[model samples]
Target: MKKLTSIIAIATSMATAEVANAQSQYYKKAEQNPYTLVYDGAITKNEKGKVNIHPVKYKLNGIEIAANVYTPANYDASKNYPAVAVAHPNGGIKEQTAGLYAQRLAEAGYITIAADAAYQGASGGEPRHTDKPQFRTEDIRGMADYITQYPGVDAKRLGVLGICGGGGYTLKAAQGDKRFKAVATLSMFNSGEVRRNGFQNSQLNTVQDRLKQASDARAQEAAGGEVKFSGVANITDEEIAKTSTDLYREGYEYYYRTHAHPNSTFLYTTSSLLDLMTWDAAEHMDLIEQPLLMMAGSKSDTKYMTDEAFPKAIHAKNKELFLIDGATHIQTYWKPEYVVQAVNKLVSFYKTNL
Candidate 1:
């Protein structure tokens, strides 16, 4: 018993140390880029003959939503175009991977919009960073609402591509919202399954304990007390290196070191787990009757989520799971070679479906 207790203590200490580091290792100032994008090859200026980005805002449930709409080079509003809504990952803003994919899709002659989730990033909501599954799903629907109405957007040809947690929410959105004729997910992650069961089911035995924590947090919020939070605010280089999974180790480097953005973070209100714990992205997979394209890095630790969810879409039309050889989860986010492969696959998928 004594030796077991010591092991638990050491594990706890390591986890704490992982979350107690200083600010992001490579955070970029919001003023550095005119559009506040922090990814490589981001658009610095909007030119007439080139791909153009337009900063846009709309109301979702009375809250202001901030987004970037990218139009293809030499775009003409008078002509119809297929539009895609790109959903960012958990803790991601519209300016990171989502924006990168949005921009790339635009370059392929598709109009794309990447929006910050409600209650996160530049979007308006109280008790910021409330990461609820419902809100995230609604954000995708809202994107469809706004983009379908944009000039030259052909509503019948609309599609969506979601990354990581956003991919889960996109699945939820595409289930009921038929506006999205084609659905695709890159590095798909099932947020609820991971939250409830822990990554790789490592916390299977502590499910009740974490639920209690979430319950307590909600009670505190109800009493107007302090709002509790979860997730890492910062991580050290040593911690990043020690992280066992490629998903998290590479994720920290991408979000906090390599492709850092001022508005991106890994934090969320603890009370959100009340809703998240009981949700599952693959709940009604068959409801997604649209053509589906699910892609993931072959070497990603999170690839299991995609594997588990893809086969369940029993009724989906032309559903396929494409693996990017030798790429991990985070690599799909920024690595040029992997990004090119994913984008090419996306273009081909969207072209055939949309």
Candidate 2:
């Protein structure tokens, strides 16, 4: 009787542990499906174009992030092709700048996948726009996994390109992950440094201001609602400083209006500011073994990030930094001339490296 009682207790304990594990897994899946934004309609590929666009879904950090695959015109399922994964800027969608870059790269004879980061755009995640650096970095790695397994994609020749904040994440991914043979960034924002210190370290000089802002944000969050975020919306004459070294106003105009999508907005959580404070994408630049390319608009305020990050890359014997004189940060997003220049550079870089 004593032996039977002991056996029954052990069995019950084991069953309880299994039940707990199952619940944990279920909650994780729930976290991944916290939210989603569906596109009103599909974006069709141009018949005359050499690229075909297809919607795809993949899990990143357990979240089901959505992406679009652009296959070269002559894509043969039996023949593997080098793949490029494009990451979009902060608060931007896959359909914005990243999509354009991916499509162009695909047209240039590469398989490209442009993805919406977790918690933003059409991707799935809780709290809507939480910007976690580690998670964002994981998103890129997840894309590499998705593409390598994809039909017609040559895993060994995988490449990554990131625009704006996406660029920062790409750098982080390349530094940590060996899957990406080549990595590149356009107008990369050192999110962690920028968050801790304002653009150009202007705001970081004093800790009091940052503390106060964080305190207020926490209070707002505790009040049972989402925290609000602020950023450049529509550009105005008054917003442009007379002695400003960068063409920030013009850049905002290009991104916020000319090429803006209804689903894309600059709103993020005030809590995200805290995350950015510690998020440094170029922390281990010297460790990345892959080829690196950093491109920036000489006239943009965000040029400092690219400038600082490029010189620190140690393992990359092959690295290039191209500065476009007349372009501003936003102009590089979708301006006809600047976009053409960027796409050309990207295609050239990937072709040479891959």
Candidate 3:
């Protein structure tokens, strides 16, 4: 009888704990805010003589794109300022790390703009969360198009910084777009290689199986059937804890917990894999004549991607690969020490090359 009672008690405790976890948010929503900047130290209001956030919208290939352009303190319309186009990670929105870096660069006197990919985040598109390389690469080019004409921007002095999967697309974009005089990547991720072969090639055996799933998803859309989505919509704390790789485990915590945002998510249209699987970010590396800088966490599990793409830029007359000491893949996103190192290095690189 005592054993039965204890079992029930334990079960009740577990249930209560799960309930609490479900109701709790790691990052609470700030009340009465015009902009949705969720990262630490985000600007609550636009104040003069300080870093100001301007929420702007523009049409990208006929689809409206939501973006935040950060202008440096005391920005004047007539004065010339160097500009940077920042690309967010695969599942990230402009309100997360991309905003953090944009704000940081703005603080350093550079005008930076970070936008959501057309089919994702607060942007508008049918069958939302479509993650395609071509669309993403165009997003980077779109930033260049918009920022170059932005007040006080010097088109010739434009630069770009892409994080995670954005890094991969930036490489492809720079291959053809000569507007970005300097190109840099943070914790670069080769989306095509990973999507086709799987993370670290762990899903290599299931590549054909995944491709079939994507094909089926596309067919469903064509037939006006249910739109199938892939990737995690929601993750339990327990599931996140059990995740094996540092990239995925910390990524879940970052996107779902610590730096959570409403518009950010892990899921993408399964059909996106159809284009993602066959594309490679490192292709046509020689076409990028601009100076390149690739930075990655030395201890990151995904550092292999950066390593693979860095050497392929053979034609970059000036190219440097920087390693942040003792930082993991996700650590570079928010950890203060790591972020400072990356920002400082980036400032120097852009100053020299841009």
Top lDDT hit: 1
Error of 2 at 219 (Å): 5.9
Each prediction's TM-score against the native?
A: 0.93, 0.81, 0.93
Per-model RMSD to reference: 3.5, 15.1, 6.6
Off by over 4 Å in 3: 1-24, 30-33
What's the lDDT for residue 6 in model 3? 13
Give the whole-model CA lDDT for all candidates, comma-separated.
Answer: 0.88, 0.73, 0.87
Please give the lDDT score at residue 128 for candidate 3: 93
Clashes by residue pair, model 1? none
In model 1, where do residues sit more than 4 Å from their true spots? 1-25
**TM-score, cand. 2 vs. native:** 0.81
- Inter-residue clash pairs, candidate 3: none
Better of 2 and 3 by TM-score: 3
Deviation from native of the Cα of residue 156 in model 2, angstroms = 0.1
What's the true lDDT of residue 1 in model 2? 11
